[model samples]
Target: MDVTVIWAAIIALGVLLYVVLDGFDLGIGIVFPLFPDEDERDLMMNTVAPVWDGNETWLVLGGAGLFAVFPVVYSTVLSALYLPLVFMLACLIFRGVSFEIRAKANRTKHLWDLAFIGGSTGAAFFQGIALGAFLQGIPMDGGRFAGDAFGWLTPFSLLSGFGLVATYALLGCCWLVAKTEGDLQRRLRKLVWPLTVMLLGFIALVSLWTPLQDPAIAERWFRSGLFWRLAPVPMLVLACAAWMRWAVHARHHRTPFIAAIGLVLLGYAGLLVSLWPYAIPQGLTLWEAAAPRESQMFTLAGAAFILPIILAYTMLGYWVFRGKVRHGDTHHYH
Candidate 1:
């Protein structure tokens, strides 16, 4: 292991961790509309309130890892994704404000909830667009994006954006099933059927698009044996997703959320197989964009210890707040 490889692994792990942890909370926001009544919405918000902010720790780590290990890549990517990045950040701000305003304001909490939903949907979709564009490779000059501001506004990117929103909504709905009880659980269960169908459909669309857009991907996928190696990931994901659907229908709330988390893990594993060694999909390999060996080693020293502490704290938080949030939920700011 080279220092660059070590740092790349660290960065990739951080991104995956962020996705698995924060994704459901974001999903919850996205699916807030699916709930029938106002109280259900509040309960969904309450379910995520305790742990959502904490889940963003991995996002910070991922951003910092990129700055430390691959500043060139970061500069290029951020430049390329300037508009989508702004959209994502704006959504995050609106979401945070929604959380704050909803708790503080008594008469107009509904507005805040709507704000949160819009923000979450906007953020998640724009992020997917960013992913689509990165995979599609932007033209670069001197390690910076050399294209129009609307460079990411492609048909494929928009489709991926919506797909991500759908995925998050499904994740959120299942999370509600897990942490909620009574009416909320029932409502979430109702969502499982339609959402599962949407999830499968989105995956199918992405599968079709991937090979068509990048023939090299299809070639590499089947030729390098990576596809076979990674086949178990999607197989396990689908199996778990099926079990989750069944669990939701069977009125087993907890199992569905667990299965949903397993699917998220499986998705990350599949991505690792799909795009290993590449920091920017088809364009930049991790080693090519990685910082010097000494710089990477220095960052690892801090990351090695900090990441475990963050994980421990997150797990402990979940352990402590392991229960359904009732309609009349109180915010206990820690």
Candidate 2:
């Protein structure tokens, strides 16, 4: 691969890494309040405490890869998705504060708890919106961004925003079941059903909207022969989800959670394949917007070294925190 292609691969990998790493954490935050019971909340928090911060490294890696390698794509995508980006950044900030403050506050931990929810929701929803907009393709002019500031706020974007939120929440609940037991686990099982239902509904709505928004996308996926090969991804994901639903209710729990993660991975891979070779959906081909070869080589060298180390530490953190979360008696955390 040339500089542009290699760098594109790096950044794309970074984004996928972020989706896999922080994805669960964000999902948990969105689903946290599902169980209003304080004990359940503690159990849920414990499940993520050891690794949430580390999970955010993927976001950093993705951002840095963009800045270092594909500066053009970064600038254009950010400029077009400025509103959603700002919303996402603000959510990350609030969520971080809430994470620490909730553990220290004496009387008003409830406020921090609420902040976590808001931040997580804001971050997850805006991310989905941005994803939808990107997939819809930005309007580019002379190799730069030329999109309306509010172009991202279409109905399709909003629908995608909710779809991601629901998707993350379901994943979060499944994580909770895997990490906790007793009343909390039972509560999570109950929660996953509605979230699952909502996920299916959102996907169906998006499916209907996709072809309407862009006939090309419709042809690529449904009308053209590509659908024969591409269609299996969604079908596999659906089968996995059905199996997860069955497993979650089968008095066996971990298998369902594992299956849910598999479903997420497969579905995401399908989207990536559907839009491969295009850095910005149908706009700006990857090589057309690539950075200098020397710059890419330098950045790749550093990432190749650092990425694995980060992955190792992330794995270690999870391993250390493995098992049931014990949040102590009814005392206020902060």
Candidate 3:
């Protein structure tokens, strides 16, 4: 195995971790406005409050790993999506601030609640837009970014943004079902089927749009000898979605959430496989975008130690807080 490939996989793992962990919390925020009952809303907030900040750590790891291991890819992609990235960061900041202050503000709690929802929606939208733009392929001329600033704003990007909003909200709904009881749980149960249908529709659209947008992706998946082997990917994703819907209907709260995570993981796997060897799809290969070997080696050593600690603590935190978030119960960070 090449060192560059190892680093690429490490970054991909970090990205997957961040998407799965932070994604649920972001989805919770996106669906915050749906529950008008203050008690239910507080329970929803309590479900994620203990580890929301820790969940974000995987994102930082992903970003830092990309910058360290693939400087060219980082510089190029970041430069191309500069404005949206800035907006995403701003939204994240607002969301974090709102999380810390919302409970403290007795009179202005609604204002903070609004900010949280807005920030979560904005962050998820722009992240999806950035992803869509990347899938549409970067406008590279002589190995440099040659597109205009607003090139990221396209029909596909907009659709992708909305798609992610639905996807995240579905995750949130499933999570609430797993982490709450009584009225809140029942309410979330009703949302699971509709959100599942909506998510499947979005996934279908994106799946079609992705191949059409990039001939390489289309050819790689449809025309290659590897196509038959990889064909099960979509099938498995859909199967998970179906199982999640069934689980929610059956009142198997934990099953629905687990199935939801599985669905997202399958989709992520399909994507990484589709774009394998290319850090910046259609342009830069992993080796091409990788930094100097010395830099990679140095960071590799640090990652070897730090990633385990992060993983350990993350698991421990979840284990500690593993229970239903009941209404009127005080949520303590132990």
lDDT of 1 by residue, 125-187 (tens): 998899888777777776667888899999989888987787788788888888887766776
Report the lDDT of model 2 for residue 106. 66
lDDT of model 1, residue 145: 74
Q: What is the C-alpha lDDT of each candidate?
A: 0.80, 0.79, 0.87
- State the weakest 10-residue window (summed lDDT) of model 2: 325-334
lDDT of 3 by residue, 91-147 (tens): 999999998898788999999998889999999999889988887878787778889
The reply for model 1, stretches above 4 Å from the true place, is 328-334
TM-score of each: 0.94, 0.93, 0.97
* RMSD, one per candidate, in order: 1.9, 2.4, 1.3
lDDT of 2 by residue, 238-321 (tens): 887788778867957677667767766775776676677777777767777778788778888898899789979988887876
Which residue runs of candidate 2 sit more than 4 Å off their true CA positions? 222-224, 328-334
TM-score of 3: 0.97
Cα displacement (angstroms), candidate 3, residue 167, comes to 1.5
Best by lDDT: 3
Which ten-residue region of model 1 has the weakest summed lDDT? 325-334
**Candidate 3 — which residues are off by over 4 angstroms?**
331-334
Ranking by TM-score: 3, 1, 2
